[model samples]
Target chain A: MIELIQHLINGFSMGSIYALIALGYTMVFGILQLINFAHGDVYMVGAFTGFYAIHFFKLAEHPSWLSLALTLVVAMIGSGCLGWCIERLAYRPLRKSPRINVLITAVGVSLFLEFAGQLFFGADPKFFPQVLSFEGDWSFNELKINPLQVLIFVVSIFLMLALDWMIYRTRLGRAMRATSFNLEYASLMGIPTDQVISLTFVLGSTLAGAAGVLVGLTYPKIDPLMGVLPGLKAFVAAVLGGIGNVRGAVLGALILGLSEEFLVGYGAPTFRDALAFGLLIMILLFKPTGLLGLKRAEKV
Target chain B: MTPSTKIKLNYQSSILWGIALTLVWISQSAWIGLMNPYYLSIIIYAGINIILAVSLNLVNGFTGQFSMGHAGFMSVGGYFSAYITTHYFAQSLDSLSQIQQALIFLGSLLAGGCAAALVGYCVGLPSLRLKGDYLAIVTLGFGEIIRVVVLNLDSVGGARGLPNIPGLCSFGWVYTWVLICTFVIWRIIRSSYGREFLAVREDEIAAEAMGVNTTQVKVKAFVIGAFFAGVAGGLFAHTLRYLNPQTFDFNRSVEIIIMVVLGGMGSITGSILAAIFLTTLRELLRPLQEWTQIDFRMVIYSLLLILMMLLRPQGLMGTREITSFFRNRRGDPR
Candidate 1:
């Protein structure tokens, strides 16, 4: 029972990170209807940014809540700017082209970023600075909870809630939704669809950036290719939740995280990726629209 | 020309083509027999790539399904063929006659292709339903899953990779398969059934409304593409004499896709040309790695892809074949 509970806690923390990344994927997909293959690399970029920010600012020397928050903010802003630039430079011109063309471009951009990251950061893994460490775990009877896990859970939930409020209550969110619904109609209504699209990228990437830092905090190791597997799993989560549905992305991510944790905990660890990817194939086969996706009749 | 006369001419031309191909094969073999190992290796690689690119064009270009899992099929073929040769036929190679060795190679290659085709058929059944980007993701998932499975299989040396397979692939085999793949794809595309594939590519719903079974066409394209990919994989395994799960990852699939896209998606001749050009370019760029800290080749390749999409998205040949160029030169606008 304790083991199960511990696995649940681990799953929840991991799932929250996935949910954060999935939110970005779902949001960008909602607006552009283009699967940003580079979104995962953006997560890697964010993590890299955080890693640099900590060292540049010498936050590790005096690791505190303030330094950690500062580092995260810098990373988020850096990633947000990168997201906007990628959209403008790589994706904007191909807006009128075929989806496959845009998709290929996305892939190219992803490869470029990954390789570029490897070039710049070196191919080796780095230890993420322990910025959010504590003395001991909070234990209740036989159950234990690490402070880092709590911090990850708390930070991710806060970001998600902030995203929800922004989407539901803000004017920018309204523009984003309108643009996603009908680009032409939204533009005709004087909504700057281009800016809205950029904003969507920025917002999504910021969340992913935060997730990157959080992941680094929990795992404490970062590398150039760290985002590939998690990014893919998050993509599966986004699809499982329904491509454009925010809440569905979160739900799907939690489920994926739980299943992954359980599989590794109980099942053979080698088959973990197979299980996750197999679920993607199964979902695509059975419910092309995804769990929360609304089926629209094909209009003649 | 009268239909009867035209049919007779086509039969004569096909016979002449057969003789021409045989002559070309003999001459090329003799030529390769005297060449240095380096250039021969490049040519062989290019030939295998030609097979891969052309086969992929059948699916992504003509059939209009975005399959990002071509490398997975290729890996399946490679691993399967390598396993079979090493486990079942490794001992017989030294004692066997030339004819027997040739037969074993043929059987293993066929076995490899058939295995890949079976997997392709199963993958296609569920995947062909999804359109555009969704299908791309599913295929990507399948490719990654294959890699992960192959990585975990201890019998195939696991992540360390399988090595010491018999070096069965020769330039002769590669070129022959390349010709066969190209001829088969070309024949299929020019046939009436090929028109159905083009129709599906143009618009799936319209094609379906026009009494074409879109699903069936998709499956057909996928299976044929996969079969050739497997053949290419078998060729790759035997020639390289090493097989790793990582070798057939998504990057490899993207490389194949790049060849197809760069060559001109629906143009067989374009695929051939692009495969040659890109493979040559990669080889030429191999020496530039010392000047840079990173793989500038891929960096340049990715940038070129983005620039190409922005500039000339239809690729080098677009939909026009080499024959079309000749026709245009003769004042026949098509």
Candidate 2:
């Protein structure tokens, strides 16, 4: 029972990261109804930004909460700008184009970022600098928890709560909801639809950036392509949670992470990655609308 | 025109086609027979890419189904073909006559294609029900799953990969198969079945309303596309004399998609031209890496794709054929 608890806790930590990323996917999909294939690269950019920030600011020498906060702020802002630019540049022109055309452009952006990253950073993986060294652990009756896991859980929850408040309570949030509900109607009502879309990208990219830094801190290894797997899994999570539902994204991510953990624990570890994708296929087959999705009547 | 003149024109056109095909076959054979190994390798790769791009175009362009897991089918074909060739004829092929070796090669390629087609059908059945982005995600997942599964299986060398498979794919084999693939696909698209596939692409609900079995048409396209992809994979495997699951990763699928998209989706001639151009461009850019400090070819390619989508998403030829370009030049109304 204790071992199971331990595994569950581990899964929850990973799930939190996925949930954070899935929120970005869900939000963009909600407003645009287009899958942003380059969202994963944004996560990667966040990690790299945080990485460079730490190195440039010499935060490791100070090893304080303020420095960590500073690094995260820089990463978030940097990633947010990138997200905005991606929207304004690659996607805006294709607004009136076909969905598949936009999707392909998104993929092109993704490939551009991945290869550019490889070219700029080299293909070798970088070791993320640990700004805060938390060596402490909590253990009870064969159940143990590391400080890193606690940090990850605490940070992700706090950010998610802030996001929830921003989405539900802010004026921008209302505008976003209106825009997603109906862009033309929202625009007719004097809401700045384009700005709302841009804001959505900024908010979503900010969260993904935070997750990226948190993942680097916990895992301590970063690469240009590190976001690809997590990005894909989070996409699956978003789909599982009915895509546009924020709360459903969290629930779905938790399930995905837990299932992956259990599969790794019990099944052949070699099949670990495959298990998540296999689950995606199975869920898609059974519930095309996803777990929390409501089917809309098609107009013939 | 008179009936007699029409008959004469038909004979003339067929003769021209025959002459072109013969010249192509003879030239390919001569190149393989005489060219340096380095240049020969490039031509072979171009042929494989042509097959992949054209086959994928059948699904993505003609049927309007977004399939990003084409490399999965390729890997299946590669691994299966290599397995049969290595296990059954490893020793026998060494001392066999040239004709016997050619026969065994053909058999293996066919087996590989059949296996891939079967897998494609199974995957298509459930996944093809979805449209657009959902279908893309499912296919992407399937591709990744295939890669991971292949990585774990040890008998076919697992992560280490299969090496020293017999070199059965030559310039002749590649050219011949490329010819066959193009001919078959061209025929299918020009036939009534091709119209059904196009109907599905235009609008599925409308197609269904018109009594087209959209599901059956999609499955057929998926299967046929996979078969050609598998044959390409088999050719690739034999030409390289090695098989690695890693070779058919998402990047490979994307590369093929790039060709299809850049060539003008749904245009076979465009795919063929784009494949050859992109393959040659990649080779030509090899020296740029040495001269500069970075390899920017992929960067250029990605930018080109984005720019293409932003400016002209229809691609190089759009839906028009090469023959149409010439006909237009000859004063035919476009």
Candidate 3:
């Protein structure tokens, strides 16, 4: 029972970060209707940024909330800038081409970033310096929850709530929502569509960066290739939740995470990927749109 | 598009030319005048790739389905051929006259094509519903699944691939199968059925509205493509005298797609050209790897792809055959 609970917590911890990244994928798809394959690589960039930021800030020495806050700001901003540049350079031109061409371009950009990252940064995994993580005592049926895991959960929930507030209440968020709802309507209503798209990328990348930082703090073993699986999982999460729906993606991520852990417990570890793909195929075959996805009815 | 602009390959002369070429292939490669093993392998590789790219061109170029899982189907062919050779055909070949060996070779090629065709049908069923990126994603998933399954199977060398695929295939065998493949594909493409496949690419809704069965056309293209991928896989297994799971992974699929796309989506000759060029280019990159000490061929490859997209989005020859680039240019306005 304790192991099950522990696995559940671990699953939630990983699931929370996946939700953050998946939200970004869902949002971009909502507005553009294009799958940004590079989104996962941006997550990697964010994690690396955080690694550099934490290393430079010496939060290991300062050991305070202020240092932590400062490190996060720098990392998130760096990731946001990286995301912005990638969008401007690679994707902007392909907007006029066929969607498949754009997809191929996305793949090319992804490969370019991954190889470039591999080239500049060597293949060895790096240890992220610990900041606020602390081991906690077992409570409630002997399930121990580390402070880092708890912190991740808390931070993720807080960020999600803040995002909700921004999207539902703020002017920029309103413009974003309007653009996603109907780009033509938003543009005619005086919302800057290009700016909205850029902002969406920025905001999505920033949240993903935040998730990266938290994930690094929890796992700490960072590498250039770390984003590939997580990125793939997040894309799956986005699909499971229904491509354009944010909350659905979050729910999808959590479900995938939990289910994967359960699979690990009861099934062959090698079958983990097979199970995930099976679910994907079945979901796509039956639902097509996803759990929370709505099909847009075309008008003649 | 217009009847007046019909392709001008002289069929009667080409038939005579084909016979002359076959006589040259057989005589130049015969045992009393023995075919060199080195040349045999290259000839076999070319034949296999011709089968693969021509078939893949149907789905990717003609039908406009961006499937990157051609290697998955290829691996399926490999696995099936391995099973048949080891369990069924290997024992029966003890009486091994040249004619008996030839019959077994024929059986394996057909078996490989059948295996690939079946898998292709299953994969194509998804395409009837999904469009564009979704289909690509599914194909990628399918490729990964094939790799993982091959890795886990203990009988077929588990993570290591099944080795010693009973090397009965040879220069004559490969060319014969290649002839069959080429003739079948050529006839299929020129027939009215090929017109339906092209119609799906020109406009799906219009094609569907015109009483054309889009589903059947898609299924047909997919089946043919799978058959070639299978034949290629079989040729690869027999030629290399080994088979491994890694040989038909995601990257392998991407390599095949790059050939079809780089050559010209629907152009059979373009795919053939691409297959040869890519095969040689990769071999050439090996020397560069040792010399440059910067062994990131993928980096160079990625850059090449980006440049291709930027410069020639329609690929090297587009939908036109390589022959068109030269022969059709005569008496042109330019």
Question: Best candidate per DockQ, number?
Answer: 1
Shift of residue A156 alpha carbon in model 2, Å = 1.2
lDDT of 1 by residue, B1-334 (tens): 3567547745764775577678657967678779888988999999999999999999999998999999999999999999999888888788998789888888999999999999899878875568888888888888988899999899999999999999988887898898789878877887777999999999988999999999999999999999999999999999999999999998899988899888888998889998999889988887887665457777777887888898999999999887678567877546
By descending TM-score, how would the candidates be arranged? 1, 2, 3
B72-103: candidate 3 lDDT, tens digit per residue: 98988878776777667777667678777766
How far residue A174's Cα lies from its native spot in candidate 2, in Å, is: 1.9
Residue lDDT tens for model 1, A170-220: 898888888887789999999999999999999999999999998888888
Model 1 clashing residue pairs (backbone): none
How accurate locally is residue B324 in candidate 1, as Cα lDDT from 0 to 100?
70
Point out where model 1 deviates above 4 Å. A296-300, B1-20, B291-293
lDDT of 1 at B56: 96
Q: After superposing the true interface residues, what Cα RMSD does each candidate give?
A: 1.1, 1.3, 1.3
Backbone collision tally, model 2: 0
TM-score of chain B of each: 0.95, 0.92, 0.88
- How closely does chain A match the true chain A in each prediction, as TM-score? 0.96, 0.96, 0.93
Model 3: residues >4 Å from true position, as ranges?
Answer: A54-71, A133-141, A297-300, B1-17, B20-24, B27-50, B87-95, B169-182, B291-294, B325-334
Ranking by lDDT: 1, 2, 3
RMSD of 3: 3.6
